[model samples]
Target: MSLRDRLTEDLKLAMKARDQLRMDVIRMIKAAVLNKEVEVKKDLDDAEMSRIMTTMIKQRKESVEQYEKGNRVELAAKERQEISIIEAYLPRALSQDQLAEIVDSVVRETQAASLKEMGTVMKAVMAKLAGAPVDGKLVSDLVRARLQ
Candidate 1:
């Protein structure tokens, strides 16, 4: 089944199970997907859906960090719970070593040499690593380390 279908099914399950946290997160995801579809006037494929999920996860992570910094532990914990629920729909994350290997290959393919070529290298690496759970910041750091 497609990601959309799976999410819909899970939404039903969450509702039936009275899982408030899961239901809230799933509803948020659905809203984001629907908004994107409406904006683009097209149905999202698995890759597009995965990108949406990634964005949602990123937003939650940022919220968690901000909340923690502000000493709002309760809010941070809530964000963490949302993150865990959203992450269940993502593919297994790539290890740092694996991410590094792919980044190396992309750099080689694009002939990206030096920090100035970082953007080009990042675009290529993201394309290759699409649908995998690789952290963008980590990838950027790796690319910078490799290029410089």
Candidate 2:
């Protein structure tokens, strides 16, 4: 089944099960997608939806960090719970070793010999990743190290 369909099913299950936290996270996802749809005046494809999820996860992580710094343990814990719920729909993250291998391959494929060609390398690597939920920071670090 498509991710959207699965999300809808899960949302219904969460409602029936009285899983308030899970339901809230799913609703947040739907709202984000709806906002994006309104912004673009069209529905999002799976890749776009996946990108939205990734962005939301990143935002939550940053929030968790800031909350912790401010000594707000309860808020940080809540954000962590929300992250776990959101992650259920995302693709499995790539291992660092796997990402490094991918970066190496892309560097070779694009003939990117040095940091001077970082843009070409990044574009190629991101395209190679497509919709998979790999970390951009990790990929860029690997590519930079490999090229150097």
How many pairs of residues collide in each model? 0, 0
lDDT of each residue in 16-115, candidate 2, tens digit only: 9999999999999999999999999998988899999999999999999999999999999999999999888998988898888888888889888889
Model 1: per-residue lDDT, tens digit, 1-148? 8888999999999999999999999999999989999999999888888889898889889999999999999999999989989889988888999998998889889998899999999999998887777789999999999999
Backbone clashes in model 1:
0
TM-score of 1: 0.93
Error of 2 at 24 (Å): 0.7
* Deviation from native of the Cα of residue 111 in model 1, angstroms: 2.9
Model 2 TM-score is: 0.96
Model 2 per-residue lDDT at 148: 91
TM-score per model over all chains: 0.93, 0.96
Model 2 poorest 10 in a row by lDDT: 134-143
